[model samples]
Target: MEVPSSEELLQFLSSCLSQIKWRLKSNSKRRLEIDVLALCTGMRPVVMIDYGGKMPELQNRLLSLLELIREGLPVFKDLKVMVIEDMIYLINVRSLPKFVSSSLDSEPELFFIDLEQDPPKMVTQSKESNLGMQLRSIQKLFSSTFPLDDSNTDTTTVLDEANSSQTSLCIDLSCCLQDTKVTIPTLNGWLLDYPVVYLFGTDHIEEAIYNLSTKSLRLFKVLVCRNGTTEKDSHLEELTSAI
Candidate 1:
C-alpha cells in the first residue's frame, strides 16, 4: 500500500496532540493557534489549528514581522524565531524556507542517522527531523524554526524580559513515521524543545514587542482541526483576537 499523505499525517498528528479525535478546533479552543504554531515553528517541535480568514491576516502580520528581523529591524528580534514556524503554518509554504546559516549542534541527533551504511548526507534540514529522519523516508517538509537566530537574545526584538526563552511539545513515534509503519504496538514520546519567550494573555499579542521588555510573562500556543467550509462563530471573537 502507498504511504500516508502529509495531510493524513497532519490529521493523525493533530489527533495525537489532543490525545483525542473529535472537535479538535473547538476542543483545543483558545490554545489552538498558539499550540499549533509552537509545534510547526519551535526550534524544538509541533500545528493543529485553522483560523480561516483571520489566519491569513495573522500570517501576513507574522511574515511582515519576520522580514523586519531579516532586514535587521531590532524592534522585532524576539519574534523572529517563531516567524519561521508561523511562515509554514500561515501560508501554503511548499519549498523549504532557505536555512539562515546556523552552527552545528543546534538540534538533537538526526533520526536518519541510524539507517543506511554510510551516514546519510549531512544537512541542516530534510524530509523529516532527527527522529523522523530515522524512520521510513517520510517528508520533513517543514524544518525547525529555531537555528536562525543570533547566539544570544541581547540582539533581538522580542522577549526582552526573560534572559532566555524556550518552548516545547511532547511528540510520539507515530508523528515520525505515520502510514509507512502500521500495526505498531504501544508508542513512547520524546520532548521536542525550542527557544521561546512566553506571553501571558491574548492582549499580550499587542504588546509582543513591549512584553519582551517586561521580563515576566509566558508564551502562547494552540491546536485545531478543520470542520467543513464555514467559520464556527462560537469562538469567533477569541479566534479573531488571536489572529
Candidate 2:
C-alpha cells in the first residue's frame, strides 16, 4: 500500500490526462485503473488494487512512474490522504500487496465511478499540493497496508486441509468480523432493508438461526448451501450449531 509519490500521482494524472484526451474520441474503459486512480487521488483515501498478468506492463509503468514521482514530487510524501479502488487477491499466504491506511478521522471517504453519466473530473499538473503532505499521506497509506496478525495458524491449517479435499471450500470470514464477533444479525437487518442480497453463505445461515432463536429475527431470507466437502462438513456443523 505505497501511496503514490506526489510526483508519481501527478505523473499518473498526466498520463490520465493524456488518455482522457485521447479516449474522449472513442469509448474507453477508465474506471478500473486511470479513473480509479483519479477518484482515489481526489478523495485522499488509500488506493488498493491487485497486480495481475494482464497488467504487468501497466504495473511496471506504474512502478516506474511512482519512482519518477518520488524524485519529482516531494510534496506527496507528507500528504495524509488518498482514494483507492481495486480488487483483492491472495497471491501468497504470507505477503500480499494491498493499501491499508486508516481514514483521516477513522472514517474513510470513497467514491465509486459512475460509468453511465457522471464522468471523472479532469485534473492538470499543478504545484498546489505540498510534497511533504503527500509523502506523509503515502506513508499513512503504506502503514494501512501493513500486515495484521499472522497468528491464524489454525485457520491456515484448516484451509490447507480443506483445499486438499474435493468438496471443502474456505470462505473469507475476515470481512465479516468487526471486532471478531460476527455482526451477522444486525447486518442482516440492514440488508433486509435493501432490495436484494446477492451473496449468501453458511455464516449468514448461522446468523439467521441466531436471530430466530433470539426471537429477534430480522427478515426471511434464503441462504444457499453450496455443497461442502467432508473436511468442511465438521466445521460447517460447528458453525451451524454455534448459531
Candidate 3:
C-alpha cells in the first residue's frame, strides 16, 4: 500500500475540517510544513500523541513541524488549544454545548484510527516507547492527584479485580469507577449515589467511550462528543448556542 503524501493528507484534513465548518487558519506555521514537505519527502514532519508510550524524538519532530507550519501558515500556531480531563468541559467553555450533549461523561467519545485509511503510521515502536515513558513520568508526577488503589496495576486493573477476570478492559464505568455498591442480601442493589468519585483509565478516547457506554447500560444520562470539537467542527454547535 502506498503511504499518503503530505499534500494528500493536508487535503484530506482540509476536507474534514470543511465539513465541520472549520476554516483553515491562514498562517506561516500551517503552510510552511506543507511547502517544505512538498519540496522534500524526507522532511515530512509527523505529530503523534501516544498514551501508551514515550518518545522525545516525536516531541522534537512535532516542534519542527510546528515551526515549519508556522512559517507557512501563521494562524495555525494560535488555533490549537489544549485541554485535560474533561472533553465536555472544553466544549462547554467554547459555548458549543450541543456537540457536548452526547459527550457528557455518560456518552464520552470514540475515535478510530484505521491504519488502512489515510496517514499510515510513521511513528515507530521506539517512538511509541518514548511516548509511553513520558506518559509514565507524567502519571508519576500527578499520581497524588489521580492515585490508583494500586499504582502498579495496569490501566484496566479495576475491571480485572472487580469482575474476577470476566471483564476485559471493556468493563462498565460503575465497576471501573467503584460506583456500584455491593452490600449483603439485606441491601443487594447497586447504589445510585457516589461521593468523591475518581474515574481512572479514562484518559484515552476509546476508554472514554467505553465508560460512557457502560454508564449508559446503567441507565444514566451520558453525553458523548469528539474531543476538541466545537462550533467550527459540528452543527450541534447551533443547538448548543441557541441554549
Candidate 4:
C-alpha cells in the first residue's frame, strides 16, 4: 500500500469537510457549521465532529461522506463511522481496538456502521468491559513507578487508589514533562507542540485531569482552553497551525 504524503492527506480531508458543508447547506437550508476536531495516532486519522444536537441529519450526511471517502481514497477505504449522541467519529477500522482500549471510565455508546453492506448496517457492542481494559492499561503503565500491592488485586480498589493519589502522581511526573517530546499527529504529519485541551464543562475538566494523570508517563501534554474569547481563539489558532 502506498502511504499518502502529508499534503495529499490534508487535501483529501479538506475536500471531505467541504463536501459535508455543501450537503448541510443544500439539505438543511441553514448555514449550520459543525466543529471538527482532528487527531492522528501515527498515520491513522481520527476525525470527530460535533453535530450540535442535529445528529440525525449529520449522521446520514456523514454516512454518505464515508461512502464517498471509501470510493475516493483507497488508503481510508476501511474507515469506520460512529455516532454517539451529538458527536460523530470517523476513524480507520484497524485503529478502533487501540482507540477503545485507551479510553477511560465510561466508554461512549459506540454505534459502528458496516459500510460494505447494502445501505450500511449498524453494529452495537457492549461497553461494559471498556473500563476494565482501560484500568489494566493504566496499571501496566504505572507498575514500574508505583508497584501494585500483590494482595489487593481488585480493579475497583486499584482505580480508587489511583484517583486518590492523582495529585501526587502528577507532581512526580511534572519533572518528566520537560524531558518528554510530545507531538500530536495531524493529517499533514506530526507537529511538536503542547497538547490542545478543550473544556466543555465541569465534566470535561475532570476527564482532562483523569487522562493527564494516567497518561503522563506516556508523553501526555496539554494546554487547557476555557470559553474566554482570547483562550478559545488561541486554541483554534493552535489547531490550525498544528494541522
Error of 1 at 138 (Å): 18
TM-score, candidate number 1: 0.22
Ranking by TM-score: 4, 2, 1, 3
Q: What tens-digit string does per-residue lDDT give for candidate 1 at 137-179?
A: 3222123323233252232222222213332111112232333
lDDT against the true structure, per candidate, is 0.30, 0.30, 0.28, 0.37
Worst window of 10 by summed lDDT in candidate 3: 184-193
Candidate 3 has an lDDT of: 0.28
Q: What lDDT does candidate 2 reach at residue 200?
A: 19
- lDDT of the structure predicted as candidate 4: 0.37
Better of 2 and 3 by TM-score: 2
Question: For candidate 4, lDDT tens digit of each residue in 61-90?
Answer: 666565665677666565655432234555
Model 1 clash count equals 34
> Which has the greatest lDDT?
4
Off by over 4 Å in 4: 14-47, 51-53, 102-243
Worst 10 residues of 1 by lDDT: 182-191
What lDDT is reached at residue 143 by model 4?
36
Give the TM-score of each candidate: 0.22, 0.26, 0.21, 0.36
Off by over 4 Å in 3: 28-153, 156-243
In candidate 1, stretches whose alpha carbon ends up further than 4 angstroms from where it belongs are 1-29, 33-58, 61-77, 80-103, 113-243
